[model samples]
Target: MTEISKISLRNLQKRFGEKVVLNGVDLDIAPGDSMVVIGSSGTGKSVMLKCILGLLRPDGGTIQLDGNDIGTLRQRERNALLRHVGMLFQGGALFDSLPVWENVSFGLLGAGGISRRDAKDHAIETLAKVELDAPTADLYPAELSGGMQKRVGLARAIAASPDIIFFDEPTTGLDPITADVINNLILERVQELGATTLTITHDMASVGKIASRVAMLHDGKIIWSGNASDIDRSDNPYLNQFIHGEAIGPMRPDVSTTMPKETY
Candidate 1:
């Protein structure tokens, strides 16, 4: 009901039988805003994203895109609405057998009518935007280093020029310098497109480089949110524990409640 936000979630709730993943979650992302959601694993970060993506259905609450409730749309209508979105998975999620160019242009190719030659050309151009040279497009995912694979994934996500993008752990496994490079690329591409982006990352460094605003999810709810610059100065104990990588704080280590321990 609020067009003010590009994406809005209100009292979002989800459960997997006995376990509740998202409990009364609420958040809003404004147009062209880069909002990063940070939390330890199993804190419902992915679940919340999935709900918004409509990959998983929430048991309660509403997900709105430009003020229209997604749940109210028909299946075909929903699919049409989703066409404007792009995603970069945590693991790159490239098809190992496909050439890098095919992977980058997967969505573009899927829409039909584009010749393979043109698709490859478009893919190479997109790759260049991510600082990857044209020759890299001929290789498969396995042939590239971890950093290169990430760049290809980023190229794919932006190839379609979607107005909204989702990044799941954009900088997961790489040297700090490599991670920083990827972070900078992400910032550049998003700014270039002027797209609204939702990124899920525990890496404070990536958050610092990419997020305009930061929200922390804990215990299936948003516990803190503010301008990215305010993270370090916030007096919230949970945030302090997280950003500082402290072992003790308001957050406890429950095997059932967290993702892998994050040092960033």
Candidate 2:
């Protein structure tokens, strides 16, 4: 039997006044799969992600979750649908005022509508999933190392047992070893939940570690996609320049526009 897509986007279009960010983009993610989107900066990766998350309404096209049209949903319906989805922001995006458990349990408290007692229990359990001890939950975000902060974010993303997870630059701003730890933890947790995931990142290490399949976004569209192992075999100039980090590629990124060197 042909597997139906868990999430699908068709001819997606988004623009900011004179500048077009996503132009006629199309993609599909299968159930329990990890698909990482790789691109240079300003290539509309974030725009596409926002469109799907309903943070930014697309100027055109359709988003489908479980074959249902997302664009046509009511506010209440949207909220219900979104409860199945979770996100890890580029920054840890934790609340400094809140303790670690409260931050991890935010979505659980809101949409899951569980009591504080229950939410805290779940938060403690989820933190353990990310290899954080229970006492760590009582501490605040500011007290954690960058790697610990990221683990907390991952814990939050999986707190509600979401069927879909979004990872935005999952490995950014970390030492090589710490980044690898996060990547492994992400893979483990997502597999345990049997959730589908989409990650947008410039980090080649992340792409290799977390992606089952890879897609390249260039000039506001997905220019290429294939198995992660097949990335080096691609003849596409954009894909080649990006993966190899060659400065003199067809994209011709100038000094100010050059891609960030992979820190990890």
Best by TM-score: 1
The lDDT values for all models are 0.90, 0.89
Per-residue lDDT tens digits for candidate 1, residues 63-147, read: 9986779989898888777768888889999999999999999988888889999999999999999999999999999999999
Q: What's the CA error at residue 103 for candidate 2, in Å? A: 1.2
TM-scores, one per candidate? 0.94, 0.93
Native-to-model Cα distance after best TM-score fit, residue 243 in candidate 1, in Å: 0.9
Off by over 4 Å in 1: 256-264
Give the RMSD in angstroms, all C-alphas superposed, for model 2: 4.2
| lDDT (Cα) of model 2 | 0.89
